[model samples]
Target chain A: MTDEPRAWQVVLEAIERDLLDGRLRPGDHLPGERALSADLGVGRSSVREALRVLEVLGLIRTSTGSGPNSGAIIVALPGGGMSALMRLQVAATGFAVEDVVKTRLVLESAVAADLAGASPRPSLAASVSLLDAMESELSAAEFLALDAEFHLTLADASGNQVITATMAGLRSSIESYARLGAASVPSWPDTAARLMREHRGIINAIESGDSASAGAAVHSHIAGYYAETNFPTHRLDDMPA
Target chain B: MTDEPRAWQVVLEAIERDLLDGRLRPGDHLPGERALSADLGVGRSSVREALRVLEVLGLIRTSTGSGPNSGAIIVALPGGGMSALMRLQVAATGFAVEDVVKTRLVLESAVAADLAGASPRPSLAASVSLLDAMESELSAAEFLALDAEFHLTLADASGNQVITATMAGLRSSIESYARLGAASVPSWPDTAARLMREHRGIINAIESGDSASAGAAVHSHIAGYYAETNFPTHRLDDMPA
Candidate 1:
């Protein structure tokens, strides 16, 4: 007899292989647990375990009760699931703050550049509106929320779901850290003003279709703010200003 | 009373919060399932379910039997779990091949530039060795395996675990598609020769510390090969050369 956990893994991989090869697709319902267990020569419990993991990973949605939709159905990767996974991993692994910051700079700057380079150019309406909203008096938490929305909007404008999902995943951790870092600022008003100006500069660069300028502005905007914090700044100095 | 699935989600989020806030870390043993369920006011099954999801995500390692070492121990993010999740999502959702290819160009180019810019400079010995190994006669599957190793080696050289994990997650899908595309090549030897030349060019650029050349070579190297396949090529034309 197959070992219990290994049996589930085998079932998972079999289903995944079908998905990867295009034999399974979005909107398709997987066979019932009994059917899958019989077909794959595994216990029903093993099949259920595999389906549960798939549901958590956002590869499928599972429903209860007996009906045509009761089994697992393939679906688009949910952004929320991706974000939660990223946040959990970052938290659990304790990735260096510097590495996370640098990674963000690389990803976001590229996003900005891509948005700027799009023909006919993508609209920055959502991002610009967030910047305008930032001009109002707001607490650090409120400001950070808008700041995240602005960046996420820009990521969306790049027209890449993978980049957008990654950005979404990183946003919560970035916000929490930014909140903590805000407590150490010598002058909140000055920092807030500067951040607003930088946000506008990023928006203007994208609006003007200057990919290089947009990329540079995003890089400095991120690196400059992080430099003020106690987090190591030397790692970022190597990046072009 | 909380429903079964919701209860597990609560337990999952509770553990996740601890991990995110630095209370839990790699090598730390989680409380026993019975104790955790009692403390959190849930059934033991919920705790077990949560632990199972965490293990599958590679956030913890669980061993059997009774001892200090028996319960789930927090662990660093495992690349295998991330890769499996990504591959499954890509497969089930049918993420447009064009989008996946463009995302690779953006990420791999940045990885190349970072490797080129590292101080004291990273060695390309491992990557170069793979290129040398590719010169020998090999089947499509064999060559693709080496090809993946070469790219992964470069990703590792970039010194970012996050990027490396993302690249690893994308590798299998990339390999499978490349294998399918290879069947259409008019002459395997000529295509293999051209790919070898491009690999040499990428390695040379990194070795010479030319960030721009390295980035451009990677971008074009990916785009040029994909252009020959039935996959959409127009998506790449908009990307910066």
Candidate 2:
């Protein structure tokens, strides 16, 4: 006779297969833990554990409310899951930070190249709006928020939603470090000015449908910042002051 | 005074910080559901809901035993996670299957280019071994398995684990369809022979440090598969019966 499989694995497989089969769309609500356990012939505890794994992937949202539908609602992929996993791998010595940086540069450059060839000029209205917001910002935090919006806009204009989402996740995962890096600059104004200049150049290239130039501009922009700081990639312990 | 934060968000942040800070690691066990709920100051059910999200991410594995170490364990990222996510997006109309194929071609071509560099020469041996394995495979399943290994080996030889892992994930995700497609060709031996020839060509390029040819060969190998099938490119729901 076959030894019964673990209850949690059964629960995990059920949900996973549903996801793979397209039965569970993002935003779909899952049954309550007790109900799921009962239906699957598993313990409630096992059901709970399976759900935890899915959350790490940013696939669903969980909440408590006094109703039948109050449980895990399938969430859109979060902006942090990919980078969180990447960061974990980096921390675990599976890869190097430099390698990650290089990967990012390559992927982002590819995105820029795509943007350049886009039939309609890349729409930077959102990016421009964020740039406008940044122009008036005085504090580091204020500027950093706008800075994120600008980069995300660039990713979006590339017209690759999957890549844009992944890039956004990567950028946001290291966002605190980025802000700290910006703050550490002796000449904050100068650093911001440099970023603004690069942003302007990128916007110009996108507007002119210059794919190669846009890709090169993004490469230089990233490389220049790292060079300025001597590429001060931080460890997980090095959170903002 | 600020109200208590959402339990699920609290659970999500706790897990994120734990993973990032090295408090929890892949393969490390988490406390039992009852204990975790008490420690985190939430009801047991809220804890379960949080767990659901994590499971979708391929992050944790859980089991039953009353002992302290017998509970949820953080696991290595599963190969299925990326594929499942991509499948959903493809199903959701976020990207076409042809877009996925083109993206794969772009990524693999880059990997082939990297393998052409001398510094990464030692890594190419794995791909060569996989090619040998494919030559001896007798069954479709065995052939598919070796084919998967060969592609993954190519990724590793390219010297970027991130890209390798990503490509391996995407390839494995669509693998069943790929195997079916391969089975459909009336001239199976001819198709296998063609693949062997392309593999040899790629191996020769890597051996000779010819980056351009290696990249071009891989591109042609993938694109040629579609052309041989008389399908211009990948399309949704287009898998062979």
Candidate 3:
């Protein structure tokens, strides 16, 4: 509980308090860097560094023009903070590919099961469309991207915000790993075809409102992918995509 | 991308850039308040605010004093961040008791299943101890905390850092719900007794290396709890715990 403060840290705190307390809201513009420096007793460089981190998290939008609206404005980017944090951790920790796959299997299966049981049942139409798009995707990179999107869409349709966010973060963290792993498969077409079939089974279960089948389908779909390979590993940062 | 930067957001981005680039590692002290204010061109108040949020997220530790170790230090506190964020989000979202139970079912059951089938197998002894602690806890709050520790331990045993973190986050977020829901039961002792029994069953399954039994036991434990109350609903913020 020491009280010696860092100038930029203090500045960060000031902004966060406003957001939590409602003094700041999305789309609100902040004071200029120079004004803030004068008021907070910190150097201009420290302030710039702080803002850069927030931008990376997608919490604020920065404009460079001389217009009134050209300053930093508060904006809420979906899954931005979560995505950034998980990606950093993934890269930092160097988590294994098997760990990721198993986690995915657990997460997606849960989502699918929940979706199956929801009284009003979410639509899998969007998921079906994504799967359809993936079927025709030409390159491994493109196919992988669409594949990630498809899973994300399915998670989103589950309507559980916490699960949705967690699933998205995990998926995104491994998105690059997944792409590289996909590229390494000796039979890309065969793997893609297998994935497509799995996706179809999952969608079918969800459409039929069969929670058990949906959960089982998603579980097998994910487990099968990892089983086919000995969980081929890749460093997320080293991934080209 | 507009260039008008929000003062605090600017500070955030700057910090992120440093973190991503590995310029600042854990335990590095940031510049003092007045100096950073001067550097970043933000008010002292704003810098303070941003630091608060970062602290809440478990990214940095801030101490105020008259000595060398008295400023903000970049330190890793993933558990703290996950716990705090989950608590806040659960409060804000007003998730149902059933939602929490459902989530636990999915995560814990899946972990059990995965561990059961693991080639070399993993230990479930630590989780068993946690369950025992929960059983012996004198108060509802204490029991709830131990219960969370139990599940987190299980997640770790699954040997997936990603799922471990995710499970920890999910459990922490709904901790209040678990506490409140448990306390809300007609007889706290009876409820605790039932939970202990269920935990024992799951532990036995895990100890015997029966993956299917472990998964089934976990699922039954969670599903049974929810069924007891017919999935009682409550406002997230007003949850008992």
Candidate 4:
């Protein structure tokens, strides 16, 4: 435990400090690899390795070649990295399906209540637009994808980056299960229709500024679907919302 | 876009599938680097890289040299990876301090309510022990660390792995900010005394099965601490909880 932190970790923490201290912001270019190596007194290879990790974490984008955009640029796309972390963690068996669904219930219900309660409420225009798209004739896969987006859209509208990112990741990590469960529903059309209606019900509750109902609507909307699915080991019945 | 998946990605996905499918339970050792490289038709270096990513993500622990306990072993410890990912993200400016606090409130309050509501209550013994640990004379840092653990122990008692890991990540990410805020707290002893009282209050509420009060207690407990802090920007005043 007393061992010196590795060279790459040193580079990572230095860059992190720079980011935290506002030396790096979105669209800013990092000092070149050679310059970073010299400045930090680490091998160039260590700099490259840290940059790769940063890129994978969606903090920066690295481009190859000698053009003006060749070096790593801070993009700070939090959603993608969070989504990947969640998706991979679920795939690696670290998160159970029941826990994911339960966590989603906690977040989405809060978002619904918050969004509805906001002064001059934030735009649900994106969500409204997506609901329109869901009405179009599409494959089951496409509809489910949009369904996931509608819930995510509400989270996005809340403008809380942590909730939005976590909701997106949780929704997506279970997407494959959603896709699989689609086949088991008695009638895809009926199920899809019911979900679309529930989506509007949630929107109505939020739009009306009924905070409590908005929360309840989101809760029942999620739980109702889980009740209908063949999700194997997890059941939302034990949970009221 | 049609480029073949990278060899390392293929190896990573294969291992993830093995874990998801129950072939790679915790304590199982991954195949040797040479064998995995040959089996997956990727170079040994690519296999090593994928293994390195897995180790960093806390899905496995890698040990050097020849022994039964050596090589990469599946640890599947979710909290460490989630904590590292979240801490890095927060440092990189992907998560606002305000958002982290709000997210923690959402998850922690839900855990409080749920634990109080459970018919056959899960053990609060761990949290009880942590609160006792907090009563000891210690540095502000040590007290705050134990404070963080007390909250985490409640989430753990909830038995929701996702919530537990996410709360651990969120709490640890803001730790430095917490330490920094300690200086402006006016009287450390008074603040620590209040926090200890609130800790007992939360435990008392949960034990008494007052789910609503349990939730409120947690919300106020957190909001009260933040209210005292001279945290540059962000406040809990905007949202009630």
Query: How high a TM-score does candidate 3 get?
Result: 0.71
On TM-score, the leading prediction is: 4
Interface RMSD of each: 7.6, 4.8, 6.8, 6.8
Estimate the TM-score of every prediction. Answer: 0.86, 0.80, 0.71, 0.92
**Interface quality of candidate 1 as DockQ:** 0.36
What tens-digit string does per-residue lDDT give for candidate 1 at A1-241? 6555577788888997777556677899888889999999998867776777787877788787978877788886746656656666777763455666777888899999988888978778888888889999999888888888888899888877777776776666455677777777898888989999999899889888899999999999998988886654222223232
Candidates' DockQ values? 0.36, 0.29, 0.17, 0.40
Docking class of 4: acceptable
Could you give candidate 1's per-residue lDDT for residues B1-241 as a string of tens digits?
5455577788988998777655677899999889999989988866776776777777888887988888789876747666766667666664555666777788899999878878888988899989989999999888888988899999888777777776776666455678877777888788889999999999889878999999999999888888865553222223232
- Candidate 3 lDDT, tens digit per residue, B1-241? 6867667656766776565555666778877777777789998766765665566556777776868678898765555655544443343332333555566677888888877778787777788777766755478887777877787888888777766766776677665556657766899888889888887887788777898899999998877776664444544223232
Give the alpha carbon lDDT tens digit for every residue of B141-237 in model 2: 6776887788778877656666776676567546656776777778877888888899899888877888889888999998888667554233333
Highest lDDT: which candidate?
4
Q: Per-residue lDDT tens digits of candidate 2, residues A101-216?
A: 66667677767777778887667788888887788757877787877778878777766655665666556545655666776678988988888889888888878888889888
Off by over 4 Å in 2: A1-3, A19-35, A61-84, A87-95, A120-122, A232-241, B1-3, B6-12, B18-39, B42-96, B118-122, B184-186, B226-241
Candidate 3's chain A scores what TM-score?
Answer: 0.86
Model 1: residues with Cα > 4 Å off, grouped in runs = A1-5, A17-24, A27-48, A62-73, A232-241, B1-5, B21-23, B31-41, B63-71, B232-241
Q: How many backbone clashes does candidate 2 have?
A: 19
- For model 1, chain A alone compared with the true chain A gives a TM-score of 0.82
How closely does chain A match the true chain A in each prediction, as TM-score? 0.82, 0.87, 0.86, 0.92
